[model samples]
Target: MPGQLTLQGKVSAGVESGCLVMESGGKQYLLVGGDPAVVKPGAEVEVRGVLKPDLASFCQQGEPLEVSSAKGR
Candidate 1:
């Protein structure tokens, strides 16, 4: 994890099939390891995680976010 980011933005529909997405600093991050049901669309949130490039998934949405923790603000 070379590029870790502490991002805060509104949760939105992920480009992937069923993933939570956050847009911050003009970048889109696909959040993994979180309950999709718990995160609402357009809800403001802060996510602490790292950008993982090698991680592959069904949801090839944007940058894969290896989320350590995420919470609504």
Candidate 2:
């Protein structure tokens, strides 16, 4: 898992439609390419995925995380 990252956080609704915010490591990360319904607002979760630092995103959702897997923690 060269670029894989495991982060513990909570999901929040993004400013834009269909986008999600992951509050982790004292920062907010944007979640892309997954079923947003899998996570709920303010619910604690752990996400395993690759970081797409160079990916473009809307709002101030920090970096983009192309999540590979996620679950309630």
Candidate 3:
């Protein structure tokens, strides 16, 4: 997890695409994994994870993050 990063933002669950998204430092990231029950729409969250650019996703709006941890902030 050398390249892992910590991100804090308000989560937005894509209604149509079914992806969890977080915006931090003006950048958007498509979130994956973590505490699913905690990652929800309009919730403040702090996540520790690494980016996976090659990961294919139906919701292609943001960079994909393989989440290591996610918790309510």
**Which residue segments of model 1 deviate by more than 4 Å?**
1-3, 35-38
In candidate 3, stretches whose alpha carbon ends up further than 4 angstroms from where it belongs are: none
Best by lDDT: 3
Residues 9-73, candidate 2: write the lDDT tens digits: 88888888767888777877888755455666777888888899988776666689888887887
Displacement of the residue 39 alpha carbon in candidate 2, Å = 2.3
Candidate 3, residue 18: lDDT: 66
| Window of ten residues with lowest summed lDDT in model 2 | 32-41
TM-score of each: 0.77, 0.82, 0.92
Q: Best TM-score goes to which candidate?
A: 3
lDDT per residue for candidate 1 within 20-70, as digits (tens), equals: 778889988888765555456888888888888788877767788877777
What's the CA RMSD of model 1 in angstroms? 2.4
lDDT of 1 at 55: 86
> Cα RMSD (Å) per model?
2.4, 1.7, 1.2
* Ten contiguous residues with the weakest lDDT in model 3: 13-22
Clashing pairs in 2: none
Steric clash pairs (candidate 1): none
